[model samples]
Target: MGFLQPNLPQLDLESWRRGTRNERMRPLVAHLCEVGFGTPDVVYLFYVVKIGLYLLGAMAFAVATAGVDGLFSVGDWWSEPIVFQKLVLWTMLFEVLGLGCGFGPLNLRFLPPLGSFLYWLRPGTIRLPPSPALVPGTGGRMQGTVRGPVDVVLYAALLGTLLVALLADGTRSSGDLPGAAGLLPVWLVALPLVLLGVIGLRDKTVFLAARSEVYAAIAVTFLFSGVDMVVGAKLVMLVIWWGAAVSKLNGHFPFVVQAMMSNSPVWRWRRLKHRFHRSFPDDLRPSGLSRALAHGGTAVELSVPLVLVVSSGGWVTAVAATVMIAFHLNIISSIPMGVPLEWNVFMILAILVLFVDKAAYGVGDLSGEGVLVLAVPIGSAVLVVLGNLYPERISFLPGMRYYAGNWDTTVWCFTPSGLDKFDAGTVKAAMLPHQQLERIYGEAEAEVPLFTGYAFRAMHTHGRAHFALVPRACGESHDDDYLVLDGELVAGVVLGWNFGDGHLHDERLVAALQERCGFEPGELRVIVLDAQPIHRPTQSYRLVDAATGELERGTVLVADMVVRQPWDTDLPITVTPAPQVEC
Candidate 1:
């Protein structure tokens, strides 16, 4: 009956679903479309194009330098002139002229107009020209303007001409005859162009134009010099290689060849074994049997080039090779990471070869012999080491101390062993005995006053008590334990007793008071609280009176009172209650 009683009408489910059909379907479709593919690959492709261009430029230069005729030359190619070489020679000449005259004045004439065009084209890349300002004058103000296109072009032209001139000169002097002839005309044209460029660099508007030109010339000259040095060094190396080969076939003793061969690994190892065995450490066996396999490999690598240098009979080539080897060795030694000790050994070996060649053969004149002579100190050092290991019974005069007078005169004094004669009487007086009278009196006294105090009123009302009288109990307490007198803190005066061998003094407490409490030594107030019994078996305290408002030794006690101990245990007596008692 209950289940049937609450029956209600059911609504249609299809009506509610139909009302929101578009809204539910829209978001589901949007999320499915949003998930995209991989990232863009344009950046990697751009870098590849840039690198290819740079490589292409370098290849072009190399091909231009090495003539096409040389590249294609066969066995009997001595007679023909190279067309490509001639073309390159002419091209360089035109480049020199263009730099000196065309670019030089042209740069000045078009710089402003060109810059304005470029700024418009690439608005974000270029900066606008600055506005001119007026300078105050007695008569009127004068306006200053920036350097225009003409001035800038003239400066660039001068720099270009200088570079061309330097390159031409280097090629003529250092290159082969054909190459020299090719570059000579360009060099000649550059000289006149340089002069013309300088003349064209006129800046009538600027007051400091002359100074600017001078600085520019100096800077360009230095830049040219650096370029020349690099080119010259390369040329020299090439020439030396050619000369060494020629000298070897001629059957002459090439000193350069010998030096190079000596620097080579194989020759160095062979000689190091034969001649430098005793000089190097014994662990590095010269006999080859005890040596590592790597040493033999290094020897083989060095030997081949060295043999060529020696056979070549070019002494200069040999020396250059040796220098190269030394440089390489130095580089190895200077590496920031890995195998530093091994590299150091290599450097030392190279140096040893140089020294031996200079010493034994005197190959480069008597200069080598002079170096060997100066190396006597090295031998002496070895001898000093040997001397230390072995003992010798030897004696020398004892060192003496002398006193000098005002006029640079020396006065001799007796040695330390003769001190007995100098102060014999003072020594005897110190040794003279005295009876223990104080101890005897202390024991004989019917009553020993254990408590003694000494105090001093401040010298100047605000100033310190000039002196302090210390009590024996003061040293036993901590630094914070102190006796205050007349409302002023006083802890500077204390017993000089040192626990654990008299090392701990009251100086630390005094210093603490001066620094932390802002009390100078002259501002100190002291009260000596002596804990001794007063006319009884019980412990008592006393406060001593000051003499001339200063607390010092022998100041008499002013007040005495016996106080019962709170506890019978061996605890330190309280000096706190002692200060409270009126004197």
Candidate 2:
């Protein structure tokens, strides 16, 4: 790939024009392993610039806090507990503003580059309530989906609350350590935490936008004073590390490494990139090298955090922190699809501050109410437990399943009928995904960029399974009848942004769209694939149409998908037909 241009595969342009969708995949998916989605070098630079803006914005927020004043002199006050607390709030605010994880061309946001604040602040947009029966003031007149005035208030209030907290001064000078800076009052930090919880119950889209799993945990720590707060934060990070490591125990994570490296701007060597695949153009299944790296990294994530916490201020702690720092830096350099750049940088800071600087303050230092602070990590662990067991109900983020190649995924299959309805019926902030891609790459050559998005997905283990089942979801003549897309893309078009949580675009979401678009039976079809449960070998799936309800329900063996190529659309399935609808 050139610094200014995309190095696309050598293909017969006329042959591609004549080939069917399945036929096109043969070359496209292969090219994905070697050349990636053929994204231009300039686009990666665009993300690098965005990362700077996000960091500068965060530091500005922290600097506004009365006690903190380290712009050019970060080394002077970087270790202050107050600085740590303020940055946590700023990160939550950053993500909530749609500038964090799912922002820019990396996550497929091309036109305006983000949809969070735009979609949430507006009235009459779509909103998905977690449960209308349990939560009053939810489920609008339009089949429990429309965003009424109440929805707008809840979202805006959360943003306003976060801003108020970010700009507020510290409550008092810290007693935890001599000369430590003042910390944000417990109430100020708690206020946004409460609002985020309320907003989450109202709309998971806004909730996930904040990247609450990681940020909320840090926010919880701010409520505690002194040593207890930092130790509690360390434990919370531990759970996150453990959960991510355990999730990688499956046959999926290698796919993540290969795909991540394939698209990475830092990894310009194509031969080294091909090394992750079995034989590159022929057998694109993960090579031994990919698995070794995936599992080896998993071992590091699991063991290092424990050592970082258990080892009191010493070389052991420093070594553990160094290992973890290198781990996060490696990931950040890859500039993975989700573009969780800020989070990685924060983790590096966390290792330095919480684990290394405060290494002497262990959980043993907890006194009185500080012991109760243990509940934060305990609660996070329980969520991870439930997430792994019941992935369909819980998002991978909350389950602590960060980038382990396991995800609840969906494939949106649409004909012109459904597309027309979706285009006309929904109230959205951004243009349709294909439209945005075309606007960026031109209508004639948009497929190169569009399929690049799919390449990223198929690099994951579940994505291969999702594509294999697309035929069954769209029907036998799916290739000719429907244009298949990752549910995340469609979610971005309709919901404004998607951070890889399929629940945002699952059957429940389809029900919401069905209420508005009123699709005919053949118009819209969705294939919802749940993340593989930790205890189960197979992942369950559902096929649904917008007009009708479920069309089929079944399971696809993980064994079948792990071995197939990215474009292999035929994996044998264990299945049961849905109750047929009458004309």
Candidate 3:
């Protein structure tokens, strides 16, 4: 890949278009092993620039604290408890602003380059309520998904409260060292907590975008006192690491490592990228090397944190901290798809302060607040366990499975009429992926990036099964009649922000879209795949048409998907048979 231009694949689009769906995927998936997405180095540099700004902004927020100094002198106040607390809040604020996770070309957001504040602060964009029938104000005969003036105000209020807290001076409650700045004011900490929860009741999209899972938990930690507060935050971080590690213990993760490593600019060697797959260009299943890296990383995630958290400070703590710092830095270098660069940077800083600087504040230092001591970890543990056991009911984020390949995901197939209706009928911040791609890469050459995205999805285990099932979703013309797109991209367009969570674009979002755009039977067809239950070998799936509702439901064996090539989509189906479609 060049500095400014992408390395387009050498293929005849006219002839490639004439092949079968499986046939069409052959060369594109092959191109992935050699060229990956062929993304230019400039795009990755763009994300690096954003990361620098995030850190620069964090420094600005930290120095705003009265006692926190060392704007240029790193050693003076870098270890301050209040500084760590402020940066945590800063990361959350950055994410919720829609500038963090799913921003820029990598996430396919071009014209506006972001979705959160642009859509959330506006009054008429779509919103997804956590519940409809039960939450009193969330649903009505006509106002279930519309983001009215009230929604806008609540979103604005949440941002305002967080800013206020970030700017507030730290106070020394019963929870500080002799000369140390205290934690954030308890009321300030609790206000955004309440607002996020309240706003979540109205729109889960905002709640998840703000990353209520990690940030809100840390916010709650600020409400505790002294050792209790520090201990609470440590437990929250531990759960995040452990939960993500545990969730990766599946047949799916190697596939994730394969695709992510391929797209990464750091791994510029094409042969090295090819090795992640079973055989370069032909077989795209995770190779043995990919499996080894995936497993080794999982072990580090699972074990190193225990040492970091329990080691009462010494050379042992130093070693563990180094390992974790390296772990996060590698992820940062990868510049993975969602571009969660700032979150990883925050983790590295967090490792320095929480584990190294404050290493002595482990469990042994808790200030006899036994109730809070038990509650935070216990609450976090339950979410992780339940998220794995029943993924459909809970989002993967709250379930603590962010980086794991296992996530509730979807594929949307839009008819030409369906695409037009969607483009015209919805109030969205970004244009459709095809429209944006056409403008950026030109209409003739857009297919490379488009199918590269498909190859990226197909590299995942669910992508294997999801594609195999697409012929069923489209009923007849897999080529002539449908334009297949990733549901996450669609969610970004219509819902404003989606961080690779399928729950954002599942049946709930489909129903909302039908309500707004009113598609005919086959105009908008979707394949909804839930993450595999931890104890179950099979994953459940649903096929829904925007107008007709659920037409089929079934389970695909995880074993079947893990063994296939990226372009290989044939698989046996069980439970519901043929889709209910009219010729």
Candidate that scores best on TM-score: 3
Off by over 4 Å in 3: 174-179, 577-583
The Cα error of candidate 3 at residue 415, in Å, is 1.1
Per-residue lDDT tens digits for candidate 1, residues 1-583, read 0221211112243442243222222222121112100111232232234334433332343234323223334222221122212222233322222211111111111121112112112212111111222221111111211223543454455445544433332233312222212223434444534543342223211111111121122222222222231222222222222222221221111211221222222332444433322222221111222122223323433343333323323564455446545544542322211112222232233222222222122212223223333222233233322322220100000000000000000001112222222223111101100112123224322011100001011101010111112222223331223322221111101111101100011222223222333432223333322211112222222222211122232212211110101111122333323235668
Worst ten-residue run, lDDT, model 2? 172-181
How good is model 3 by TM-score?
0.97
| Residue pairs that clash (backbone atoms under 3 angstroms), model 3 | 175-226
Q: What is the alpha-carbon RMSD of candidate 3 to the true structure?
A: 2.5
Give residue 322's error in model 3 in angstroms: 0.4
Off by over 4 Å in 1: 1-41, 44-48, 58-145, 155-583
Steric clash count of candidate 1 = 18
Select the stronger candidate by lDDT from 2 and 3. 3
Give the per-residue lDDT digits (tens) of candidate 3, residues 79-107. Answer: 77777778878888899999898888888
In model 1, what lDDT does residue 373 have?
A: 32
Show the lowest summed lDDT stretch of 10 residues, model 3. 172-181
Candidates' C-alpha lDDT: 0.23, 0.82, 0.85
Candidate 2 displacement at residue 275 in angstroms: 0.9
- Once fitted onto the true fold, the runs of candidate 2 whose alpha carbons sit more than 4 angstroms away are 577-583
Q: Which of the predicted structures, 1 or 2, would earn the higher TM-score when compared with the native? A: 2
